[model samples]
Target: MSINAKSADHSPIDEDAEQLARLGYTYEKQFKREMSFWGNVSLGFTYLSPVVGVYTLFASSLGLGGPPMIWSFLIVGVGQFFVALVFGEIVSNYPVAGGIYPWARRLWGRKWGWMTGWVYLIALLTTIAGVAYGAGTFLDALVGAEASTASTIVCAIVMILLATGINLGGTKLLNKVAMLGLIAELSGALVVGIWLLVVARQHDLSVLFNSFGAGGGSNYFIAFAAAALIGIYQYYGFEACGDVAEEVPNPGIRIPKAMRMTIYIGGFAATFVCLSLILAVPDYAAVISGQDTDPVGTVLSGAFGAVGYRVVLGIVLISFVSCVMSLQAAASRLSYSMARDRMLPASKLLAHFQEKRHVPPYSLLLACVVPILVILGSIVSPDALVVIVSFAALGIYLGFQLVVLAALRARLKGWKPSGAFQLGKWGVPVNIAALTWGVLGITNMVWPRTPDSPWFVNYLVLLSAVAVVGVGLIYLFAKKPYTHSDAPAADAVPPSGSNRSVAENAQSHHVENYL
Candidate 1:
């Protein structure tokens, strides 16, 4: 009954198809498996994009937690690696599209999967919008245009459309662009970090210990917690590797490896870049005391000069576009996976794949259109946009924890992961650790520490999470989308020694209920 079972006579492709059949699904050969392991890593790395993360949040983190805030990357990186391990095991066993959705569906039930996917889908779309919007800010700077909310929104929409067009070209182009993005982003980070450290270093390593009066001398932990967003936001895009599970050959083996590589490589790059920027700042006191509002730009322009700064700015823009492209691809795949299960409105259309291109056209369109709408909505109330964008990281963490919880539930019900990669005796401990880290992370993100800000603004992360789940609950009960699909429900493996396949066991349970 284990999906990992392989026969000497069966080829890997044949075995994969057999596994899919055993899970009550047919293997669609038209869905090309063109991505190699490195390509998968590139997708995730570009999505993680240290350039985007460090550039966007450098000033905020420095202001809030001082130079010491650079350590947040290490802290968050370790926690996310635990998460990556959990995901690797799940995806290796299921090897299903829609990273979290399908894995949750198989581990727990349809309802759990539906809600997980729903929350994750909204979060992913919001993230896409946020990334594109960030890209727009950089693009405006690159073109020497004035920066404004209106201009940013307009530029964001254009970027979204560009990413959508590339995505529509199919997985091959996605892989190639992702690899190019990986090269540009990594090289840019290295060049920038080394240049700053060697030529523009203004602070010694000891400066990392100084708090610079952050947290008002009462609670440095609170300030650190607030600053943790820099790491939390950057670490997650690794899951995008699993989002394209169906497009990678030998995915059971390769995707897990790629996921780990993303965390290891991406974490080091982010940390190095953050450290370099922190050391290169002209004055930490100015940044912390609210004098230097644009510390990131100050350092880059000062270190690289005017023309060199523009070149670096252009590289940052590429990182943003690549990040947007990867986000869009992941979001579209999640949509297609959910729609194929008839779990969403317009399932038939949303699940429609362009046979020639081997891409889900409608799903890709949904991903593009929703983010554009989100960008446009910003024009009405920019504050509302901030609230929604804040939920992106918290919502993604919630979605990840739900899958971890589901996996724990399955293990308690006697399901041992028989994947190409597994933690074995370490599974339960690692799972517990990952879940604990995730809970702490969610709390850190949602905690209202800003006494000066408005009540809603302070509590935006928590409020937005509640609002998303509230709406999803209402829709779930009213529409009963789970009833439309014939996929297995609460399909946790029974006690050991069962000869029946999982699908067979699910069917037998259904028969027994009927009697």
Candidate 2:
């Protein structure tokens, strides 16, 4: 566990090990650094899967805000890029396994990290269930099987089991599948988008600006804000890159670059796909007026004929499987990271890693089981499932903003980022912008827009956020899990003016002050 001269070795693998050692943890040889830069990017891109995002939200977005809702991609994309930059800075410095948990722990304190991870962990589980359920609907379509609540739930459980099996194969298999997913998904998106734009265009370019009375009068911004969920949900898959930091060589340098690549590339693909779908819609009035509840299917079926539409459906299914696999992998890693620190109940079991496969078996199983339970719980009321799934995007943003807030707090406390990729003077402004955008985005998402629905349904997002945080706080104080860990805390090192490296500073300070 001690840093030696080898810690100074400049080779990527050695440097990564050295970096982990510097962070007060021994290098875990179980996690071989098998993911290359592109593999890392693929995990993130597939997780972000433009196909999944657009297809899932398209009808609702179009109904709520018309063609102009497409702009949410650009707006949320820009804002998330700022968030990605903030993440890149933190991951460059920490390069730890858990994306937000370890980053928050190092930046703030143990309790802050626990709450952030708790909320994010629930969000990830909810997202897995949501994605799996969506995939089941597509699976039904591709197979020409009748879609029903029972059938979709069965298909979703199958998808979850399949993803779990693949994930248990370890990071190497995860990397290969992620890369393949990236190729299939990206190519499918490009092909479908180009075909729709060139061969099936029903509306002119200016159609994007037309809202078709979507705002219910002169309050278009209200509608636009509601539709922004399309982008908010799509842009977050970038952080999956850092979730497996130990499995990527030169993580401090490579992971940051991979993160930015996910945003830049994923954003463009999502926007292009959204735009093409918008232009290809044969009748915007029908979509806006609720006459066409399934515009995506209508467009694909009309433009591609029966056989070609089925072919596209197959590609979409692949994207969904890839997305589910990537999400499960990330969820397991986060679980493992937290459990390794003895943060969660049954920590020892959850933290157990398979020596030969370099995988956290219990953690992976936990990830798989939780989502299936969630899916099964929804059988009584399918609408209840939708309400729970709706909290996914908001929960993710809250987790992200907590990290951003932690970074800002660390910065104000005179902590300078000393990673391979520091933002230098630009750090503060970028952090501020990211935080501001996150607050606005969260507010927009939680706003009770549906007047006709029950009050609980409209305020579900806010209520869910408060409920999750409230539970976490109650547990935090009642059990005081943070006190059990010997891991380094926020005050382990002096402020930025210190000449010594964080590793050296941490080595000198006693690990104390849990309260």
Q: Write the per-residue lDDT of candidate 2 for residues 1-515, one digit (tens) a residue.
A: 32222344355576567668768779354588999899999999999999999999999999899999989999999899999999998887788898999999988989998999999998999999999988877878888888888888898899889989988998899999999999999999999999999999988978789898887785899998888789988999899999999999877778888999999999999999999999999888898889999999999999999899999999998898899999998899999999988889899999898988999999999889998988997778877787778778899999999999999988877776766677878889999999999999999988999899999988988988888889999989998889889886674235567755464453332211110
The TM-score, computed over Cα atoms with residue i paired to residue i, of candidate 1 is 0.94
lDDT of 2: 0.87
Candidate lDDT (C-alpha), each: 0.85, 0.87
Cα lDDT over the full model 1: 0.85
Show pairs that collide, candidate 1.
Answer: none
User: What's the TM-score of each model vs. the native?
Assistant: 0.94, 0.95
Expressed as tens digits, the lDDT of each residue in 1-515 for candidate 1 is: 24444578766666556656666668353467777788899999988989899899989999999988988998999999999998988887777778999989989989999999999999999999898888777777777888898889888988888899989998999999899999999999999999999999998999899987976787898888888789988898888999998888777778888999999889999999999999999887788888998898899889998889899999998888889999899999999999989999999998888988999999999989998988898889887788888889888999999999998888777776766677888788888989999999898888888689889878888999999999999989999999899975566566467644364442221100000
Q: How many backbone clashes does candidate 1 have?
A: 0
Q: Which portions of model 2 show Cα errors greater than 4 Å?
A: 1-11, 27-29, 491-515
List pairs with backbone clashes in candidate 2. Answer: none
* Model 1 lDDT at residue 401: 97
